[model samples]
Structures are given as C-alpha cells and as structure tokens.
Target: MSASVDIRSVSKSFGDVHALDGVSLAIAPGETLALLGHNGAGKTTLFRILLGFIEPNSGEALIDGLKAGCRQARRLISYLPENVAFPKTLTGREVVAFYAQLKGAAASEANAALEQVGLGEAASRRCGTYSKGMRQRLGLAQAIVGNPRILLLDEPTSGLDPLSRNDFYQLIAGLAEQGTSVLLSSHGLSELEARASRVAILRQGHLVADGPLAMLQRDARLPIRIRVKTKPADAETLHREFGGRRINGASVEVTCEPDEKMAILAALHQRPGAIADIEVIPPSLDEVYRHYSRANPDKEARS
Candidate 1:
C-alpha cells in the first residue's frame, strides 16, 4: 500500500514571519526523502502542515491523491514525532497491542511488529523501564503497524547509539524494500548521505535545493578529492606531473571540479605502474548542506 506524498504550493505565516513560502515537493512510493535544515527553518512546520495539524495558508498536502488527515489518508499515513511518549505503566507488548487495536490491528500483529524491531526479548518490559533507544524502537514499531503506505519521522534517530542507529536504518531499508515511502527530517547529514534516494533542503521555509545527492553535489560545484599512492622515489615526479598536495611519502591529494574528474583519471593512466593505488572522494553531504545554507543565510538572519 505504498503511497506518494505531494505538497503543492504550500505556504504558511505567523505574524511577521513566513514559515513556508510556496513550498512544493513530491515524494514517490518507496523513496526515502531527507529533509535538511537548521532550527526555525520551517522543517517542523512543513511536517506539521503535511500531517494536517495546521492548515496551510494556500495550496494543500495530499497523501496518494487523498486530502491529508482524511479517513483514507489517515489509514495510509503514520508518524513518529521527534519526542516519543508512552504510558509508564504499560508493558512494551501491551503498549504495542493497545495501539495496534486503535489502528484496527490485532494483538498478534503487535507481537510481530515488536519482533521486527528487535524488541522481541524486551516485549514484556514496562515502558518506564525501557532505555531511550528501546523507546525509539517501540515508537517505530507503532508507526509501522498495518504496513502504513508512508511514514513521517522527525529526528527519528536523535538519541540512538551507533549500533542502534544502524539497526534503525536497516529496519527502514527493509520497509522501503517492501515499498514503504519515508520522509524523515534530521541533522545527520553524513548518515543520510548514502541512505536517502533524494534530499529536499529547506531554508527559512523555502526549498533551496532538491535532487539526488550526486546531482546536488554537481550543482554545488564543490571540489572532489583525488588521492594517488606512489613510491617515495617517484612521489616528487608524480607530484610534478599531477599537481596535488602530497600526504605522506607515497600519496598525493588533488581537489578538482566534477567536470575535470574524467580528464584527471585519463592522465593517471599515463603513469601506469608508477602509481600503486588511487582514490577519489566526492563532496560530502556536510559540504552540500553548507553550500546551500550559506547561499540562503539571508532568511535565517531575518528571523
């Protein structure tokens, strides 16, 4: 039941501040979209508007063609807020079971969901006793019940440890394999770099960039790092020919534009056996985020 999310010409304002200005984006089924922005950049406001918590000043948010928050849309959409809450008295199993019932699913389904999130051994533990990561996994279990068509997550992995965070993303990848669309807002740029199929960045409520990671990197025109390893005896010769900064006795690092990448590689072939090894690192997500943020600093200054 994977479904698409469409935000069309959406805008919102609070007094003298504009939270969103004609923001538009479409998330396809099975796609993972990472929403990037700083505090007060309208990321949360956009999520709120998409979930229909507040009305947009203009345009609309739709779930697979149905109006957001409508009976059909509600059935297909699920959400996990940045901060999760639960009844202190309820056991993990009970909490999942209770919420499943609310969503018209059975207790057995709850057990399966708990098991899916690696919480099977802790299903009987009381909510108050669960660790922060455990609570997050429980919240994820809640969001995915009934195989929701789309999942909206805000800072979903905020407090998770490295291992737990890896587990969380793996679970999400499996869900996407089953065609579940995901829209997650986060500050974890490096983490999201490889996971998100596309990224839509928000600055002061306006979308400043939207596309696949590679495309955005090219658009940013950021430098790509190229490193080559050679013998210490030939390091000077290679440096003279390749024109890059030498690292140790055997490596040199060169920063070049994307268009120059192929030409640089072609020249490397000329050295042949003289070069022992080489590596090229593209612009990181951090650099990509910084590029856009700097370009749109005007809005942040206004607020």
Candidate 2:
C-alpha cells in the first residue's frame, strides 16, 4: 500500500549555514507533491533529512508514523537522485537487479522494471554505452523495481527527451494511482503544474508557500490576461469601450483580477458580435512560484 510522510518543525544547519528552518509539510497516501525551490534553497537539504542522510537539529520526519532512518521506514521508501550513477561495467538489467536485491525484491522483476521504463530492449547493454537519456531511463527502472510505498524523485527528467519524459510521468501517475506517495523536486514548474496534486515552495530555507495549485493562484491574486480577437473594424471600438489596449490591429488585450474575470466576460458578451474569440490566460505555475520565492528574500545568501 501507500505511505504518509510528515515533516514537522524540521530545522537543520551546517555550522552557520542554515539549510532548513522549521519547515513543516506532509504528503498523504497516493498524493503527488511538488517541492519547488532554487539552488541552495534547502530543497536538497529537506530531501536529505527525509532520507535520513542527515539529522535535523530539531523536530522529526516520519514515514508511516515511524521515525525516518529506522529500518522499517527506510524499507518503505525509494529515491531517485538528481544525478544517477551506475557501475559502468554492469548491464542495465544487472543494475536494476542489483537495486531490486537491495530492496528485497525478486531478481526476476528486473526485466519487468526495465520494460516499464522502455529499457527492456537495451537491458543487456552495458551502462557505459548508454546515452544520457537512456541512463535516466535506467535510473527510473531501478527506482521503481521494488514497488516502494514512498517515492522521491529529484530532477527526474533532467536528461530525458520529450517522449521519455511523457513516459516517465505516465509511470509516476500509475504508481500514485496504486497508493504511492510521491515527492517530486524539479525546476520544471510547467511540467509539475499539471502533475502535482499540491505544491510547496521554499525560500531561503523557509516554507514560503504550500497549497493546491488553484488555491495558490487565488492567493497570489495575479491578473488574468484575456485576449479578445475581433474583426479589424471592431478592434478599436472594443479597445476604447473596454479600456484595454489594442494589439496586432485585430485583438484587444485586457487584464483583470481573478474575481473580476466573469464580470469582464459578461460585459464583453453583452456586445454581441463585437468579439469573435476570447483566450483567457491565468497566472502560470512559474509566476506563482516566483511570487512566493521572492516574497521574503533575506540579505544573507541561502546556502
């Protein structure tokens, strides 16, 4: 089955460099959470703490109600680091089988995991001969071999091609459907925008924002850009009446607060045939990420 992860009041420091400061977050069974931050923003530090690679100065991280680093808790987790490495001499199948052994899975599942990541065709090939994308797929195969309860992926699509990335996300979706709690860390905000069920943004080692996509967008209160396409003859009139600027000779661009969207649309519809098409563009995930990441920038550089 899946697992629940709770990080409570977790703080960590390396001498004077504070990596994380009282960050609290949780992921429910079968939920996919996106952990977003820039370099030195404590994303990796938090992951490390969760993995039990380092102890937090205060508070605790729990997996399935057990303290992190305990054998039972460790057994329930799988991780894919930003940079995946394998013994160059081993074949892809051998590498996956080795990891499966570590996770207490049957060695035979190695081929199955390879197939899931589209690496079965190259399973027998030496990892040293694989391309970067192929290596990424190999990493995915190993990470998924044991049917882990919780999966942590950092920059999982770093070197993947468009097609490979699509496959990777599809596999992750299936895993989540089966009750796996997924914690994904990536700089690809657009990619995670649609995939993650919730987003947690960190800034200067602090948890700056945490919520579902729609909630964060509403809280951001960013303007929604609406592009109205009309006949050349009606463009100027619509622009003048709507108070929006005219663009491209045949379009009027209007921006309104999220709550004002429907009102503006009703007003436009009142002018029948005044508009041919309307395209509404809401604040993107990247925009929301930037809003919180910079909300409380400190003078000291984040480690």
Candidate 3:
C-alpha cells in the first residue's frame, strides 16, 4: 500500500524560541514534496520531529495513519540526514551491512546496494577514505536498502556531482513511480522546482504556502515575469498591447496572472515578425520565501 504523511497542528518550542508554530500538512503517497525554506526556518526541526528524532511540544506527526515513532511507521520510513557520520574505522561495505541488518534486509542485499550507488569497487575501503560525494552515496544506499515506503531526505545531493545529482533525482522519480513517497528538504530551489510535484513553503516554522507548484505560484501572489524580444520600434507598441512596460530598446517585461500566460503568448505571436522570442519566468521558491520573510519580518527574524 502507498504511504502518506499527516502532520497535524504540530508545534515545537525551545524555551523562548519557537521552532514550529501551528504547522500542519499532508503528503500523499508516491508524491515528491519539496519543503522549501531558509536556514532555521524550522525545516530541519520539523523533519526531525517527523522522523521521531525529536518530539513536538504539541500536535501529531503521523505516517500511514500511525504515530511517527510507532513500529509500523518506522518500518515504512527511511531518513537521510543532512550530515551523516559513519564510523571511520568501518569499511563502506561493513557500514552498509550494518544498516541493512538494522532494517532487516537480506545479507546479500549489501553488495547490491553498494553497486546501486556506484560504490561497488570502493565498498571495501574505509569510510574515512571516502570522499564527501561517496559518503553521500553511501547514505543514499542505506536509505534505499530497506525499500521503505516513505523517504525523508535532507539536502540529499549535498556533495554529489552534476551527473550524480541527475541520477539521484532519476532514482527518486523511479521510486515515486513505484509508490514510494518522498519528502525532500533542500535549499536547492532550482533543482527542487524541476523535480518536485508539489512544494510546501515554510516561513518561521509556519507553512505559508502549500499546493502544487503552479498553484503555489498563483497563491503566493507572485508576478509572472514575461520577457519578449522585439524590434526597437515595435517594443513599445507590443508592450502597450500586452499591458507590459518596455525595459529596453527591444525587451519588455510584464507581471501577469498565471492564467493569462497563454494569452500573453498569443498576443506576442500576433506581432507578425515583431516578436522574436518570448519567455515566461515564474517566481523561484527562493524568491517566494523571500517574499514571505519580508512580509513577516518579526517571525522570520526569530527563526
């Protein structure tokens, strides 16, 4: 069965410091949800609570209708922390085997896990000798070994190379296709924009925005940036026609509703060789986060 995460009115505090405040969200099975927020925005704290590494001061974190730390929930979930420390003395293979045993994976699964992460030949080398990327790969291997239904990843591609990062995303996509849910918390907004089916934005421990990528963009009141290339003389006319303002001799910029994007394109297309190219740029998650922070300076400042 597919897994789901239900976070209900979760709140956590450290003395006078509030980490999460009345936050609630749900992540459906097989969907890749990106958690976007700045440092100390309580993304890590929420992640920890969901993984049962910490208890929320109030509210519940449940997986597949079970409490966060319940046996069944633990069995169905795997977590890859941002900073993973393995015993320096143990070889990579040994480390994998150790975790495999913890997950009750077959002994023979260790080698395959190592190979899947492109660490087959280096499996015998001590973790101390492994590079950061290699260590990250090992952590990913551990997360995947158990075939858990829900994967919680924090900065999963931290040290991976470009190719490895692409491969890692592909792997995550494959897992989602196979009914495995993934919750990813990352600062890599561009990458998350391309990978996530939905994005949940947190500001000062509160979920300021939650929905599909397109929906969030619309709900955030973010302007749609349109750039058009046109002849110097036609630029002004085109801008006036499209209700945009001319930025330069041949470039025009406009902030339009997301729904009007196609109409804007159609307007540009009607320009009869007047328009050379058109681009629609949505607000990046980083930009959206900044907007929220600016609007709630006191809350974000505390974070």
Lowest lDDT 10-mer window, candidate 3? Answer: 294-303
Model 3: lDDT equals: 0.83
lDDT (10s digit) by residue, model 2, range 15-110: 999889989998999999988888888988988888899999999999999998888988999988988679999999999999999999999899
Candidate 1 residue-wise lDDT, 24-47, digit = tens: 999989889999888888988988
Q: In model 2, what is the error at residue 131, expressed in angstroms? A: 2.5
Model 2 TM-score is 0.89
- Global Cα RMSD, each model: 3.9, 3.5, 4.0
**Pairs that clash in candidate 2:** none
Instruction: Quickly count the clashes in candidate 1.
Output: 0
Tens digit of per-residue lDDT, candidate 3, span 1-303: 434999999999988988899988888888999887778889899888887889999999999999898778899898899998999999988988888889888856889888888899999999999999999999998888868899999889878888898888888998999999999987746656367888877777877767777765555677789988887778878777776677767988888877887887776677767877787898886676566545665644343
In model 1, which residue pairs have backbone atoms overlapping below 3 Å? none
TM-score of each: 0.83, 0.89, 0.81
Best of the two (1, 3) by lDDT? 1
Backbone clashes in model 3, listed as residue pairs: none
Q: Looking at candidate 1, what is the lDDT of residue 94?
A: 92
Q: Which of 2 and 3 is ahead in lDDT?
A: 2
Ordered by lDDT, highest first, the candidates read: 2, 1, 3
